[model samples]
Target: YFVGIIILPTVREMEGREGESEGGTSTATTIRRLEIEITEKRRVIKREQAQLQLLEQELEKARLQASKEAVIASQCVDEWGKPTQWDDTAHEVLKGVFKKKTFRLHQLEAIRAHLSGEDVFLVMPTGGGKSLCFQLPAVMPGHALTVVISPLLALMQDQVYQLDLVNVLAATLSSADDEYEKRRVFDHLRSMSNKGKQAPSPFLLYLTPEMVVKSKELLAALEAVYKAGNLSCIAIDEAHCVSTWGHEFRPDYRTVGQRVRSLFSSTPVICLTATATFDVIRDVASSMGLGQHRQGGGKKMATFRSAFDRPNLFFDVRYKPQSNKDQLNALLQTVQDCTEKFGSSCSGIIYCLSVKDVEGVAVHLREHDVQAVEYHAKMEVGARKRNFELWMKGHVRVVVATIAFGMGINKEDVRFVIHTTPARSISNYYQEAR
Candidate 1:
């Protein structure tokens, strides 16, 4: 019947061509052609439906594989503290969490070494993303908590604020945080410690060396984390402080390394500093028990060094005037030039050696119609914080402050940094100059 249906059409068409009218076409022949057309259409529809099903299955498989990879990435390390699929995981967090597209020089090396459970000593200049080295590893899922011991409370507060902006879970323990805030942070840690099967919550904790040594609440929280075997790494910011030879030597910093070692012997230590001489480096390494200095010299640490030279920054030095009025004029002239060049969005710092000088300089600048504010250790905490934020947000053109102003400050558009008096030491000069 099928063959006849096909052949009969040709036969009829041939006969019609001999002299049949167009109307002579039969209904049965037309019906047979329509049936064939419907059959072909049905065949195409069936094939398309099968292809769609196959595609859906493949998509589901891909999704499952991605989910599995995410879990593995979160659990970045194996039982022995060896990295598993770290490259993929680190890059994912770098982009997804930190919103950075690429790692700066020596950044990946420092982070990778620390992730593999090796101590790291990194020397990168200010604004070189030094914090990200430890911070990147700290934010990874399934990674243990990272404790950062820093000497400056201002730096700690600034870092915590910035981290919060990016939605990264970070908390700082300092005199700045109120009792309620401190208790909240401590309670969170305690809760994580109490969870038996659940993993300890991952967070970047910033603390001063004194807090590590003196704060019983902080020590208790740390002990809880330590008992859970969830202490990931300890990063010492401004690690040069560990050396007496360094410019900003604090006796409290000396105890931090020893105390951390005694508590969490196996946790990796990352010491980061912007300025460190050979003597300072050796002292820091030895004091931290890193590299060959470790007991039995088990695993040597990796040192990541990037050149401190920032070619984009230009330096100019001029002799100060002996007269106070002349000094103010010179400073004002320099600041005006800088502000004029950068226009309204200009941000700058004028460092003074004392709180009196900071207030005086700020008053002078304001009298001259310069948008300026004063910040120093002696100022009320709220006032200093408010002024700093005003300067950071470009509401103020310049911040006249003491040495307390610039540490860990992330303002990138700052056009000039004018020191009204000489810094106490070369490292202090270098730190504020940035």
Candidate 2:
């Protein structure tokens, strides 16, 4: 009886303990579910926060774009409240001698718009008459001045020379020119701006970015001219330098947009580049604050492409052993053959990979009884000027240069361009070739 009594109490106690354990397990399961729900809620909040930040950024971008569009729209209107058209005389002059190409329509339209005080970006090919877009406007009445910012002094000089041929009063400011000469040029410009002048001054002024950035006097003079309402437009030649990816990176080019804005807010800016990829175009437009103007209805800028194909020329690539003397002789022989067949009037360019090569090749050509000249960055200004003048006047038949010969050069009759080595990139090749 005693054993039965002890066993029965123990069994009852074990049953009660099992019931308490089950209750505790159920409470722990409820706590785990609550913790899981809290974690999910935190994740959802974080996702929403990220989305909000993205939306904010997008909204800011949209606002900036809208403001730019509004400004452009306001400025594009004519005095009579209509989309402007080119002047009949201007149109006739442009279309008469100028051959009609793919961009002719766009060019005419751009000229008209620019004359009416609207900024434009003409992204045309190298030989696509980009200069005419601004050149024609520069000649128009009431358009007081067109300041062209070129990357190189040689280019500025070449442009000025070409403009002079057409009886356009054009002046260029470069480091090559002396201080006295610069002062004289500045004085002449001031005289032209005088309301009582008999013969008006040059409509176009070409300057390098370095001249503008480094000289406080030039900047002041430009500001004064702008205040007098003589500055009508600012043209950036070879504008791709604004992009870091461009073969030439000019820090001065980056300051051009701000300079335009500060000095001549009413004056329109025209950016011209020969070769630019889509990404490069976007980068340039962004760096120059042209992103909004380039975009249309929230879309990317439209690129104007002419035939990049040069059908008249043949393309060939050759890999030869490293024999400098043999290569030079062979190149000269080929040039002679081409000249003999194509006649003495056929002009060509010979590119060297380095200044040393340029000098060496030029000397060899001279020794071999060829009228050749060397052009590189290291040459003194007087030497470069003399060399360029000799080449322009047909005194020299060939120029051996270090890839700096042909930029903004107006020599249209160049029949051939020989490369000692392959160009650094296709853009460079096309630039030199064109």
Candidate 3:
């Protein structure tokens, strides 16, 4: 009787423990289900946040477009898209597209003459908004196409990129482009020609002087647009390149004027340059065939010239160290000092005479833990482009490059520039420095 009593109690205790484990498993299953639901909710929240950001970006773009249209609607434009009057139309573009509150000296005057279908020769100091004179007209509605003939491919590329940022349609044709890029530009032109004035907006086409003078395919395409009366105006940037007396003369630039005259004689031509002497200006005017001004018969070319005075830039000359080690140390010191004074984002240019010098300086700076890049004609195309972009984006604080590298540099806040060799000419130096 005693043995039966002990065994019966032990069996009851075991049965009680099994009941508790079954209840514990039920609670764990519920907790696991709740965790899964929470994970799914988090995914939904993340996806919705991503969609919200995209919608916000689209809304911002639409807002800017609506504002631009409102400004354009208030201005008066002729059938050909030329401003019927100067002040309101030009000022609207200045504020709407360029985001400037007012016009600089002579900027409005130059635009007025060009938009009024007259030849314009504009000479403004660097950063004087010379480009705005022509660029603003090109963006006007129904303005058709404005052909920009530039001396360097770099300038063409830079301008095209900048115009795109402002929602302006701009394209470039050059040897630097691949076959697909060339075809795309040509196809866009053909499409624009087909639409005529009904085309969505005005287009700016940038080309090197050689492309205008030599490319038969481009010539044929441009001819089609010209015949349709869609070729509005032609702009020659850095026009001094056409003059043999100018500091940087290119023979191909000489033929570009002849091509323009033969094909688009009725189209108004606007030539712009930063620094040109009287002799250079006269040669540019004559060579560019500025109508009666060349033959002393028709309407005189409108001239807008500004003084070359930059009161903000200070110039100092320092003797280079005799030893290479000392030279590099001095350069490193200069860069470090500028960095200390201007902060890490300070951008600078160091001009060297030779490819070897550029490479050496860039490498030395890198070894010293400075973010530096080298650019020269001798570098591979992709490498040159990559290094240039790094400098442009401020990923690299300094660029050691050849003297030719600054022609199309669009950076506005460069803190310092160093020249390892003497400038080729005073005008050349001024152009590069400015």
Candidate 4:
């Protein structure tokens, strides 16, 4: 039997029909929810795309960095494979067997390379053992005669004296030496040459560029020696002077590169300088004809830079008062204080702005019981040398002068360097400080 059900519309059916009549409300709500979900998904995808772009950029940067590192590594490896050696005798000489304290490895290497027939440029600081670079190689086992072109007479004289102290056969070709002494040196060289043997001792001939240019006989003799393979190398000291744009421009240095190139084409050249900026170094190398191919086509020339810092030196700056007398008084007081503290054991130099100022201050110091002397171009060469000698010998504690006083002097124990007037540039200041 089947249960009979009444087919009648109730209250719930009536309510559902009323709701559906309101423009399909359930369908509109469902469509709106779907639109919101799609918008959120699109935002998430856009953020992910941005992150992917950033990752790609980082990857590209890493690749470029790797390529740069590879290039530098390859350059270093090439440098490492270059042929180089140290002269055993020179090493022993520098290793304190000769009573010389401290040895620079780069300086030794530069000398050895030059002796072994390679052009070199030693860019070292002042008092950085530059003399050893050439002096050591001069004594090497060869008929090698080293011709040194010094920028100043005093520097040449100092080198000769130092060599003499070491019992090395050294001579200076300057106008100051008497004719008899000059002839004696020339005859000695000639006798050695006639014997078909190296000179009794290594002969280091020191000459200025101007002297080298003017003396036809000297030039001929040097050229002959160079042709005979007796010339070992030509060292250009104070090589920065070769650059016309440098702070210390020497007109004589301009012709040095051309002369060396013409006369000593096969002989190695060593260019040395205490202070040279990056541009100065490049200009010096170019001026010396060592920009490209060096002697013997060996490894490329290297530059050894020592730090310019001098820990022993104290840096200070004092603003000058409006009154010149006040400034002078203040400077005098400082000099007096330094002298009283350091006594005869210390020496000092005071740099002035002008020649007149130099003279005035030096006179004032002399009058005030400060043993000071003046040095300027206006002074005779003899006077300058005397003043320098007096100061070096500790007879004078203070030297009140222009910038001309410090160049080529190796007074290492100078207690202080004062500039009554500020230096023209940082390079000038650093040179004086060194």
Candidate 5:
């Protein structure tokens, strides 16, 4: 169908110059109008499809909750623990739950800090099992509610889905969730609240910072959890945003830091990010009230740092000094090399600096028969999510994206990550590429 549409230009449109057409109305202009109409219609279809998928997801979630509640009622689930020391049992539990036989050095360190009840500033490289750092501690036998403030809805969903698979009882509050979904999650929290030492399940509630600040109802619910003495830890993923460069994306992040402290004064808070400078490190600690600046000034802070090294990745700097055309050709050559190294089926993400650049690169790549999709902040949220899923599923080979494209994306086999324009900083580049 798309091929037919591409090849169906009117005779006058092909024969005439830029503006000339039959009846003094340019056929080219008519074609462009039709193309735009088709694009708008496609967007409508995608939106409807996304809504349908959301309904399906909500229904499936409800079913899962029903099944889980039944099991909880039928059996005695071990409530979470509060370990004073990192023990062999905890290690064995992690290995059993996650199907891993060993703990990475960084994982053990992060777990040790959590066991000690230290406010942590964890900076591990991307794909470095950082989620485990927070998640493992959540299952510790304790009356600790771990609230994870993630940066994006997609990220929250991904993390929750992973925990859900392990039967660890994670839930999220987000705009993407319908009322039914939200209510189910709230019910779980309410059941856990004021139960003294008995939590129905080990709960990890994920929220976007925007939701944290704007939702009065959510804030009230969090207060209930805290009042129940179940509020154990607050973790901020993509922790870079709270301090230095991330305020533009969500300024309310700072507000979240303040609110969490006010709500749970003694709760251990951890901020985990893969990107930050030496200076940004201290700033993050200060901004989140860690180290000597912790609320009461007596808490110890574990600033766990993992080396940001990828031995498998080879980094290079290429210069295209001639012209825009030359630079584009250089990019094509690199993409061609990747296509050869990996099969045509391999996927990649191409980073662009601006929305217009994303469009331009996507058009050019598509023209050259590279299955490319465009994603930027300017698009509707549903559209952006759809495009991301396309690339993730290999329906599209490349996503020409602006800076906000790849946060918390779990695709591990992205064969290439190309930065057509250098990001504002090296930190940003490492995050996208990683």
Candidate 6:
């Protein structure tokens, strides 16, 4: 009886424990099932979040595209798919921007051609109003921006300042600028590139061709503008640099025209060079995808050759003397005679063969009671620009410099140019002389 009793209780306890264990197993199984359900729900939420983000991006893009179209709608097009003659609003803008009431015949020609979306080659002399032709087109109703390529930083800055004075938005890129200025300009370009959300500002962005070809961000930005159809025109100032063997050849320049053409197939190009020969002109046109092309009923070239002859410029070549002192004396005599003919406070550039020669000439002149400054590539840019301005203001009577001194300079009262040696090419000579 005792054994039966002990065995029975043990068996009953075992049965009871087994029952409790089964209950605990059932609860754990339900917990695992709940955990799996929660995980699947989390995955679904994540996918929904990603999809929501994508939709937001698409919505933003559509909004941006709508704004761009609205701004473009403000512009009217002609039968040729070119911008029409701007309405009274354009006339008002032009009146405020230019100081003059009427355009020159060549200016009018360029303006009409530009509005017609025709590729053009403008060969106007230095100090002529060639800049105005390109500048006026940038102010038209449809153009979002104009990318002006120039080799000289000084020239870019001077042009930007002049543009600003006349109520056009202009900015230039240079390593010389501080961070704040660069950031501000980049922001402006970015917004300008974003399409119709903002009416395109009357902005002109100037950069070296190197910046366009080499800077990834800037190139992306420019490409974006063209892709958006905001590129009015590309005004290649000093466009002869596009040729490999041209004057002021920058290797970077030779590639920019082609790159721009490759990027913007439909965008028109206008190249202005004061001194390109027939061969150089051909090269530039080819690089820009513009040349003697067939339009309408007959074949015609887009090149517009302004007369190169300047009546005010008189040239005289004198052979160098054997003795160094005699050479210096002769040059001094020429300068003295020029001052006697013109006023004593006349402006001139004395071209030296090298930097050392420039320094020597300036020092010699200084020692002999001549007031002059030395300018060369070796000097700091700020100092060089200061000296150039001093000369422009007539504060200095002479500037002894290498060939580095005078491209895109706006001075017109220059009365004499004395060279230590003949330029390597006649084209170069005419350019320096004119």
lDDT of 1 by residue, 1-434 (tens): 45544435587778777555544566667988999999999999999999999999999987886565444323432222344468789999999988989988767767777777788878778999999999889988777688999877668777887888789888887777778988888887877676467886578889989888888778878888878877888899998888887887788898887788777777889999888765677788778788543456678666766667888888999879999888988999998888778886778989999898888788999999999999888888778778877887779889998877766678778889998888998778889898
- Local distance difference test, per candidate? 0.81, 0.72, 0.80, 0.73, 0.75, 0.74
Better of 2 and 3 by lDDT: 3
What does candidate 5's lDDT look like per residue over 45-127, in tens digits? 99999999999999998788656544432231121123335667568768777777787745776677666667777777888
Backbone clash pairs for candidate 5 read 80-141, 80-142, 81-140, 81-141, 81-142, 82-141, 145-232
Q: Pick the candidate with the highest TM-score.
A: 1
* CA deviation > 4 Å runs, candidate 6: 1-95, 164-167, 176-181, 245-249, 291-301, 323-326, 367-371
Clashes of 6: 2
Index of the highest-lDDT prediction:
1
* Tens-place lDDT digits, model 3, residues 343-420: 888899998888888999999999999999988877776687778778777798898988648664577769888887
Candidate 6 lands at a TM-score of: 0.71
Show the colliding residue pairs in model 4. Answer: none
**lDDT at residue 153 of model 3 (Cα atoms):** 58
* Per-residue lDDT over 85-175 for candidate 2, one digit per residue giving the tens place of the 0 to 100 score: 5566565555452433233525655666666555566666667778888887787656677899988766777777777776777888878
Worst window of 10 by summed lDDT in candidate 6: 72-81
Count of backbone clashes, every candidate in sequence:
0, 0, 0, 0, 7, 2
TM-score of each: 0.77, 0.73, 0.77, 0.72, 0.70, 0.71
Compared with the true structure, model 1 gives a TM-score of 0.77
Residue-level lDDT of model 4, residues 1-434, one tens digit each, is 99999997899998888888765987898899999999999999999999999999999987886566445434433443344555457667765324675566466556555666666777667788787878887876663578899876657766776677777778888666668877886775565444366444568899888877777877777776765667777888888878876776778787866688677777777888877656676777677667344444545555555455557667767767788788778888888878787775688889887999998888878888888988786787668768877876778887787766655567766888898877877767776767
Rank candidates, TM-score, best first.
1, 3, 2, 4, 6, 5
